[model samples]
Target: MGDWLRLTYFNGSLWRRFLIDYLFGIVVNNICAVVVAFVILPGDPFFHCWVFSMCIGSLVMWMADGCRILIWQGGRPSLPGLLGIFVVTIPVGYFGGSYLAAKLLALPVEAVLNRQIEHASPLLIMILIVCVFFAWFNWSQSELSELRAKAETEKAHMAAVERQAMQAQLQLLQAQIEPHMLFNTLANLQGLIALDAPRAQYMLDKLIHYLRASLSSSRAETTTLAHEFELMHAYLELMSVRMGARLTYSLTLPPELERFAIPPMLLQPLVENAIKHGLESKIEGGRVEVVAKRDDKRLKISVADDGLGLETGNGVHYPNHGTGLGVANVRERLRALHGDAASLTLEPNTPQGAIATLTLPYEP
Candidate 1:
């Protein structure tokens, strides 16, 4: 029943739409009758024989409207097509209704048609004028709808292009950061190998594992939260070996959100920033907590550290001249992916640390 109603009213079945058009034509014909009696044929007054004539006219108009709707529905609603239907149908309907009315009124068909032509020409002219305006209105609306659809298609195409550009920019940034991290780790390994071979070997094995996972993740545009967490865990473990008891870390991921997708390497830079600016600066190092949870319609991932808080004037000051390239990269990528719907915030954690919190739309 709901579907039937939708067909009658909405952009559904063409037959149902034609039925609505037919009904509207009947109303229009009656309104024309009122106008004819009041203004065009005041002496005749639309009574008796005139009412019968109008009824027959309404039926003819309804059939004409139905034919027009069917032709338009067949996808050839051009001006020429509409004009053709109108030219062929209008005279046939007018003359046929005149014949029917004459027969019902016990008059000669020729006499009735001649009388119609003489007296009711205004009503016929009004109907033709209304039909022309209706055709023009439909043509204008069709043009507007096509223009709107074309605009939407262009908008989507531009959005896709922008997304691709952002992805390319992110990949370039990752490429730059990855080699820097690798060179630093290798430099550290070179010194460690001379001083302590066993610790060096352990770090090497961790590096191998981290590199393998990172390579696999880099090949994909997106990764699951679980996989992202796994990569972060491997990185933190590698850092743990380097820092020993000086660096401690914890990872908490809810099982329900394990499958949530995020851009590859999104969280690692946050973790690296924490360790570099926060933990590495402190004398006793610090504990780093990486927590992931669902917050309303958003997924919140926070990287917090118990290290020296941000300097009074400078916010979350970094050790190496404070470029903040990693944080900026993450922010740009988030903007590209979710527009204004995602955010990354850097705030002071309680007591003595800095926290980087990332919030994005969550799809379950």
Candidate 2:
């Protein structure tokens, strides 16, 4: 009784369910009205059938909803339960509609109710057809909703797998870089140890400082721009010890941009490329500058070196010239992380050297 009186239906908004069901009832009832007037009860007026259908349909739909809410908790009921609800509700709807129509026309209730008794089989057949149609419609909608939910779950799983795979590839690329940088630094240190004892000790000390600063960020997936620049400063200081006056470097990070987050070791490889391919090749090695600035909504960082401006061959700037593994690593990482939103471009710096500029969507 409480369920029948309750405003809510099918775990949805009461008014929304009512409006939708009422609209569906109108459509279904009109179809049934046409069938009854033309085929089931020949010579019967279409207007009379339509009015009775409208009244019966409205009452039947309301009762069916109440039965579903009570017995099945508003979900689609079992086949037997569905049949029982229809059998009980259809007869009640027909009798109630008969009573209402009799009152409206000021006619005798017995005359109106007894009119359909002789054609009981046809009336029962019509009710059965409506019950089957409603059952099929409900089942199809439930199936479609389940399929849609399943598709969404599968899509989310695929995204998670793709993210994990990309992370693994990035880790492999980062691993390659650390060893390359370490080997070169160690090789230089070994040479200095034999030739100059004091400078070797100083280089070793600087190397320790650089490694200490890098350890934390190296293991992380992301780091702040300020931390990245600090690592670069330590790296440049270590290199300065080796090259003395030959290697001069500057890292410029605006205060506002310092807290922007980026993948770890993103700039390190760019800095390494500038030193190895650009400055180290020149007799009097020139400056390497790393500058970070905002280009509207994007973050742009450039590593520029004024040494042996890209070796031009056949009018091409970079291909014939030594770009190295660092360039490839940086490009792969950016692609995996930001897709088309991030890019790395190498162009000749004015008058001398090459500039590798990294552009990425700013994320804080």
Instruction: Give the number of the best model, judged by lDDT.
Output: 2
For residues 1-364, write the lDDT of model 1, one tens digit per residue. 4554455456654455456555666666677677777788677647643564475556555665555455444233766777776776567777777787667767788877887778756756776886776556545655766787799999999989987887787788777667766887898899999999999999999999999988888767889999999999999998998889999999999999899989988899888888888888688999999999999999999999988766534553645412377787788778777889999998878887888999999888
**What TM-score does prediction 2 earn?**
0.76
Query: Cα RMSD for candidate 2?
Result: 4.9
Model 1 clashing residue pairs (backbone): none
lDDT of 1 at 240: 91
What is the Cα root-mean-square deviation between model 1 and the actual structure? 5.4
